[model samples]
Target chain A: MRDRVELLRDMVLVRQFEERCARLYQEAKIRGFVHLYVGEEAVAAAVMGVLQPRDRAVATYRDHGHALLKGVSPEAVMAEMYGRVDGCSGGRGGSMHLFDVAHGLYGGHGIVGGGLPIAVGLALADKLQARDRVTVCFFGEGAVAEGEFHECLNLAALWSLPVVFCCENNLYAMGTALERSEADTDLSVRAATYGLAAWSVDGMDVDAVTHTAQRAVEMARGGAPCFVECRTYRFRAHSMYDPELYRDRAEVERWRERDPIDLHRTRLEASGDLEPGAFDAMRAGVDAAIDRAVAFAESSGLEPLDQLTRHVYAAGPEAGR
Target chain B: MSRVTCRDAMGRAIRRALLEDDRVFLMGEDVGRYGGCFGVSKGLYDEFGPERIRDTPLSESAFVGAGIGAAIAGMRPIVEIMTCNFSLLALDQILNNAATLRHMSGGQIGVPLVIRMTTGGGRQLAAQHSHSLEGWYAHIPGLTVLTPATVEDFAGMLGPALADPDPVLIFEHGGLYNVDAELPDEDPAVDINKAAVRRAGQDISLLTYGGSLPKCMAAADELAASGIEAEVIDLRVLRPLDDEAIVTTVSRTHRAVVVDEGWRSGGIGAEISARIMEQAFWELDAPVARVATAEVPLPYPKHLEDAALPSVPAIVGAAKELLGRG
Candidate 1:
């Protein structure tokens, strides 16, 4: 793994990028459903750090961070949100469906718990083909309430599939709290019943996520489907339209005290991996990249109306690449 | 020509696919050791082994979605839902993931998934196990729905459907599985896009597919006996309707009786009738008639179930009523 300095930069890149997305959403520059990954940067950054470029990752709708971690360029990512023809998904997917197969980001699935079965299938293929790669499926604790979650977990275990189920327990599934949504909030315990080697990690700490993910990836490669429930929280509302009525403001503030980016930055500084004032300079570079992404997204063209019916069904052998 | 059951023909088709493509595998409930719920995959598990002829748990959504996932990830997975009724559990995955992924990804991904399900009711399996919903699937744009009635279609359609880059749904009507038919001299390869004219006549067109094909043919025979000379057209493909065939047949006959085992309202019959109105209204001599299952949850009792479904007499009666000879 690269030094913590690089990890902090990726986290800051996500933080700075989505912070701009929040502002851009307000300006009417980017419309439609926008779910931000404000506080959960460490999970994507650390988990992706453990994966090779050849490996696949399936993520949920709040997936800008995951897309970036999987190496989708900031320009393509922002253009997708802009609904432009040049976006990673040609602006067809928008924020909820950011798919860049070249980057091995299988999808930006919009449905809750919808991507689990697909994830199991991806891993199943790799195993059947004897390909030495792991597929990481990222979903929230809320998805655990879905039957697909249980079904997929059981199926994956039965097959000994090469998949790592990373549950980012953001404590909420939209407006419902984890407690209200599930019988037992301990997602790891529930996963254990399915014969998977499951555990939870402190998602606020990038190192903890990295350590847990490295082991999980190893376990997956060894033909054991594992589950890692990262105890994290989204510092923002579920989406831009959310009224934020379900949770207490004090609770948000309390969780904010251990901000993932801030915690990682402090750790890097204490370990002498960073010089004083390094975060500011690093963030400036990331912000400049985000600015370029915004400019590119703004200049890109919208898909023509006549082409609206395109790709509904493939006409050729090389249909969907 | 050799005689073969629809079930064996379908099994041969699946077996051929597995032999031809290493990427092709069949996965579904009771498909492995159980030899498929309908026995359409009998002896496949032993021939292809467990890896290729995978048997999955009863979780419809997961297995179906997994098929989509595997298809997109470079495996040609043929997933079988025990029945169309059970497929409702996996509708979210099918509608949201399998059907929408290619377009949603801007054509960057296509789910080359082939989903097979048994449809229609005859054996008193009751409401849950026996109701034809292929019409409902036909409404989805990104999907290709096929209702293979003849043994030839049952054997032929799978190869072409497996070749399709997008998702394809094949609804094997439950009652037709054991029908015995003579195999042609050559391979049974046929088109998946056009309708097949089963019997040619000039009085009226009897349009149908899947299990309803035989019923329509029987009705056409009855009409022929009564000097009606009705033309029977098997609509093999459902989603991309054979509009040309539908219109041309109606133009030739100037009247049509659409037979569907599904419920009448908002069914495939409705869609076909609307298309006929749009394309062949001028040629039509009388209003198009639809013979569909009674709009009720199929009953368990044999008598009630028989009453609920479209029968030969009902189809014949509809044909006569349209021709003003009832």
Candidate 2:
């Protein structure tokens, strides 16, 4: 069995990080759109846990969780949120576009369904180069409405690209309910039409997500695309600016009762996987990391004004020749 | 030197790219078995096989985006959008992903992708297939737009475009595909950074690019017969415009006429005119003149379509009018 404490630690870290980010935003520290991954931590923790270092990942705008799970240092990501030069994207990309190319994190694409075709291309390169690597692309249920979703799915299946499309179905596209936006709310069923091996899992359960993600990655490694629909929920507003007029407060409380962190902790306690005071110790450690990250971001310098347009293109042979 | 059509020259260039780099591949609809919509990749499929020469479905967004991703993942992909008209369907991927990825990622990624599409009109293909919209693409910042007018450029431009560390769009004029000219045995090393002066003169400068280049050249010949020596400068690179070449020609000639296949209002010719006004206004003997297509969708009938696009005689008339000799 996987380490339940470690999994819980990861989920708690994401929870604490996002909570701290919200406080920072209120304190006039972090700017730009901050789409917190509050209730959907299990999806990233489990899915990213299965990915090897050589494997690549493409995430959506709500990507702080994915970036952390993919091994992007909390300090770098927090610095990025603060728009500091020490940020993962060199303070160029704000909250939505967290990119760590060295770790094979392709991007935190802001556009819905934009990262799918890119994941297919990354898989295409790996396939052509005879590399045994998988590219995991994460998108939300809302992306199903985009034309690129259909197009990318068809191409991945037609070309047999090695990609694991993880659709985190958080039940709402901003405020529109899944049933209202989609004709049929079954995302995995639609993906199956493209000849991909598709399924749905309980995203609230980390064990279920881990098991399904492992199988999906294995299938993708064998030269076939797979889709996983993680039926999850987002407890917070879509972004900090959202007033959340669409959903009722009663429904939020209902889903919050099934919080993935509390559920995972309860399961771990019943299974004797957690020692007494372990959860508190884990929280303390995570809080310490978040404190260090905030300090780093606070002390970090802003990028110089003169270098505003430096990274538009890489410095290549065409420069200063 | 050997005489060849622009079609053959481009085909040969693609063949050379495939032979030179194992990472270079061609992907588009009808690029393989159908030999491309304009036969620009006629023999590449048979020669390079299905792996390198991939024939994609009509999903422009998917394939183009895939090409961008492939470029990021260490492959040099030349994506063909059958015509500039159809590229609208793939604009999101082109403008948002391909163009912005490098800056978005803080230089962690560079899309070394080459997108080739046929631009301009002369064969009465109607509104959709006939408009020259390379100017629309030139409006974007992150792209390098190349319009190759000569057979030499057709044979030479792809190498440099592929070698560049950014996204490049090559707009090949549909009218010039069948036009034949002598090309060097070895591919000429042409730079995509500077404009080339087609003809030298001391009178009015006739500046143009793509399908309009030949018309301007013919217009220069017509002007020469009437004792008006007109200079011609082909703007090979449209995005990072060769302002130096434009200024040099206008400074010498003391007058300019920008000939473009697109409409006059806010077209590339307008940008060129504005540039001249900013840099070479003092050198002008008269206000700069522009010869552009009428502001209308290209018509289906040959006569109407011909009237809608910039013609050689129209260019000549504009030059004569600018020189006060019309």
Candidate 3:
């Protein structure tokens, strides 16, 4: 197990990194649908912490945190959001569609439940090829309503595919709350009916998520799927365009009380897992890294207009055109 | 040396693909013990067993997306959707993930996946299983759509499709599955890029593919008896269509007719007719004639089904009209 201090750093980096992204969006540096991962850092951080470099990770649109945790250079991710040629996706996938195959991060799938089947496939390939890598797919509670969620769960279990479905039940699918969307609000319980190891954990606690994810990853590596419901919250509105009309201010304030980064910091500081002055030094390091990322994004060039048709097919002059 | 059904040729192609590459697998609903819905994969399950030849649940979105994923993760997967009609259930995955993954990922990924589905109408399977929709797939930039019309194309296209890194869709007309042809002494040379001149003449050029191929051939035979040599061009590849073959044949014959089993409005026939207008307009002695399926959903009755589809009479009528002999 990684020490609480490192987990603490991962969560802090996500919190501050996305805070910068929000400011960038406001300043018009980043355009398109920007979904901030304000309160859901622990889910991505801890899950990514448990995954080996060989294991794959697939995430949804609010995916900056996952990209960061999966080892995509903060520079490349920020550049991608900036829609520059230097972006990880060569500026083809804006904020909603980041991809870094080398780090085992499949993509930032824009569709609600699109990544689930792809995750099943990645695990299917691994299982067939006799590799023990586990594929961890992250989606929101909104996706539970999609038929793909049910189909993928059944297929993965039926095939004993090595995949871990981590549902970040942030209680909303865009603006629809979990209760409004799901017939039964307990997402993991519905998942368990598919005959896999299913459970929900406090997504607000970094240590708890880390512990749960460790077991889930191992369970998947043993040659069947596992399901984890990280009951977290997105402190911000769904997107930059959202007006914040659906949820109560009081409810948002209440979930803010259990902020994942702050809660983890307090626990580590009291447990002496974090040394004196370590908190300040860690935040400083995160700021410097993010500063470099921002600088790279600002300095990067946009892809040329003529190159637009490139990569549509794998090559051959007749393909993409 | 012998004659073989197009379906058997297709099965042999898939079986050979599985044997040549360890990374190849055939997956779809009823593809294993059920022996494939169309019987194209009849003996493959017995030969390759359950590991390489796997049966999937009836969820098209999941299994198709799984095939796309497996392709991206470095495997050549041959996914068989029962028919083009059911392919609609998996269209989101096909268009979104399989087709879009390559360009959207900015050259970081390529889906070396081949999806095969039976298409066209002659059987009374009615509305659900009879419509031809490969035209819709050909409209996408990231996909390669091939409508194989001959036993050679059926036996030949899969190998190259699996070897290519892009997503390719092979639409085998359901009506032509049982059509028989002499097995070539050696495997007839074929590719996924060009059209073939099935029969040559000078009076008019007959453009067609898939189930429409035989109808056009019969139309040519009928025209030949009347002393009109009608050129027959098999438009095997639909996506990046062989425009040169179309222009060359039309440029020579000075009259053209497009035959398609898909619907008339916005169908591939329309696209081909438009291409003729664009590239070989001055060469045309008259407006290009189009022979496409009627716009109505196909009915279950055999007579109505045949009536709704392009037939030899329709092709012959269109060809004669193009030559001012209507």
Best by DockQ: 3
Q: Which residue segments of model 1 deviate by more than 4 Å?
A: A316-321
lDDT of 1 by residue, A199-254 (tens): 89999999999999999999999999999999999999999999999999999999
Using lDDT as the measure, the top candidate is 1
Which residue segments of model 2 deviate by more than 4 Å? A315-321
Give the residue spans of candidate 3 off by over 4 A. Answer: none
Model 1, residue B95: what's the lDDT? 97
* Candidates 1 onward: DockQ, in order: 0.60, 0.60, 0.79
Candidate 3 versus the native: TM-score?
0.98
The residue-level lDDT of candidate 1 at B268 comes to: 91
Superior by DockQ: candidate 2 or candidate 3: 3
lDDT of 3 by residue, A71-121 (tens): 999999999999998888888898888899999988899999999999999
Q: Each candidate's chain B TM-score?
A: 0.98, 0.99, 0.98
lDDT of 1 at A179: 86
Q: Give candidate 1's total backbone clashes.
A: 0
Q: Provide TM-scores for the models.
A: 0.98, 0.98, 0.98
* Better candidate number, 1 or 2, judged by lDDT: 1
Model 3, residue A10: displacement in angstroms? 0.9
